[model samples]
Target: MPLTARNPNESENEQDASQSGDEKPVLIEIDHVAIAVNDLGEAIDSYRESFGAVVDHREVVDSDGVEEALLKVAESYVQLMAPTRDDSPVAKYLAKKGEGLHHIGYRVADCDEALERLKSLGHKVIDEHPRPGSRGTTVAFVHPKAIHGTLIELVQE
Candidate 1:
């Protein structure tokens, strides 16, 4: 039997039937999972020992007040973030919330376009404009206040 509609209550025709062709995923894959930690080295070492993942990239982004280590996982990465200075937001986050996942990043085709689309849908954004982020990518943060407490980062590589 073909995939036919069984229940009349299930509006099959109302679904997006036009989207049958293989549409590539808008967000290719998770760019990274950023974990804010007080000690970057320790965090990296711990992850290395536990998961056997090695750091592929490391950089100190003074603009963001963070030193990060990227651990490659297939197409994605694990970004271990630590404060470079006391005034950094990551520092403040670590001081207040201890150590854990800080934000989730969604890879977008264009940061500005994604942000604009989000704003059109009534979502509050933090970065009104795209800003230079770590790893040479343009990024923006979406305010957690509107998204049920999950801080969202939009990245364009």
Candidate 2:
């Protein structure tokens, strides 16, 4: 049976997946997996030489004070990012955690609605609302405290 067409007790958000065949708020494709690196160039070259992952997109996001290179991986992307300034959050993250996995971006149909749902669920959020992201996408960040140590970026393209 279709998920929403069933008679199970659920809030609107719970049944939203079936309403539009959208899977679930958190059930979208892994849009990208971001990693923090000291040298964005080196990381990009390594991915290209070692894994043959070519750069699909590269942009310096001034708002975030970071430069990122998106490497196409099937339908997803391996986002290699580096801070452009010492005050950047990525720099802070690297200082605290060193170079490694930074955050996971989960593609969402509606970034605003998904963020509202997360708020309603009492999750801590970094972005109070959707903001412009690289590659012409809208995105928001859910604080890592909300889901253990895993920082989440909800992306809507």
Candidate 3:
């Protein structure tokens, strides 16, 4: 499915007509909401105690230098991440923003296609190509400046 360039002046019906019947939607769903924390274990424990949430998956991504705990929430996840190294992006985020929401992961049919579509629309992207993400997913990061200050991760599982 191809991503349609949206025209602000077009009506809802006109926009709908632009999409072909056999084409898949560009965005599938909200994959997860990532939170950067000071301690992964502490954050996991807190979620378990407060909301009865259990960690569904945990992994230390050496490439990103961060450990993450995924708590299943419906078809989505509440991802809690902590840095494994001082120079990691998560570590820098923690040093600057303390503990809070980091980025949002959006499930897409194809990371490459989504990236191309975003680029064609003149949106700024952090990753020029998709890379391996946690849980064997293909992902790419879109710059926050292009999405109203909210960092977006396009995830293809």
Candidate 4:
């Protein structure tokens, strides 16, 4: 039975793995995990000193209200995200959650296409359209409401 019809009492549906029947191959890969912190410079220095990893990219995503420093790890990245504005989500996260892992990002060939596919499969999304992201990429956010309790991001470089 399809997931949507499996349990009427369930508040959510699973990922559309069934779409592979005719869809193209999986073109996305886990890109990075973002951690929201109160201090960007301190986090960067700590990671470098403890893990021997250097910041590969750093940028402020004004739209998302975050300043990020990315440390490369094999094919993925460890993103240190800090709020650029007092009212940004990261600021709120730090205030309420007190600095911790925020979201997981999946690298895609086409962010717009991936977001469209996600929406078609009934996933709740934060970004109805793709937007500029840190590290010179395009990105979109998938709402946690649809993906268990994890917030997901689709990134295209």
Candidate maximizing lDDT: 3
Q: Residue-pair clashes per candidate, as listed? A: 0, 0, 0, 0
List lDDT for all candidates, in order. Answer: 0.86, 0.91, 0.92, 0.87
- Candidate 3: list runs displaced more than 4 Å: 1-24
Model 3 C-alpha lDDT versus the unseen true structure = 0.92
Candidate 4's displacement at residue 68, Å, is 0.4
Candidate 3: TM-score?
0.87
lDDT of candidate 3 over 50-155, digit per residue (tens) = 9999999999999999999999999999999999999999999999989999999999989999999899888999999999999999999999999899999999
Best by TM-score: 3
Off by over 4 Å in 4: 4-19, 22-27
Instruction: Residues 1-157, candidate 2: write the lDDT tens digits.
Output: 4335755545446557675456554547899999999999999989989999999999999999999999989899999999999999999999998999999999998999999988987889999999999999999999999988889999999
For model 4, the run of ten residues with the poorest summed lDDT: 7-16
Candidate scoring better on lDDT of 3 and 4:
3
lDDT of 3 at 88: 98
TM-score for each predicted model, relative to the true structure = 0.83, 0.84, 0.87, 0.84
Question: For model 2, where is the 10-residue window of minimal lDDT?
Answer: 1-10
lDDT of 3 at 153: 99
> Clashing residue pairs, candidate 4?
none
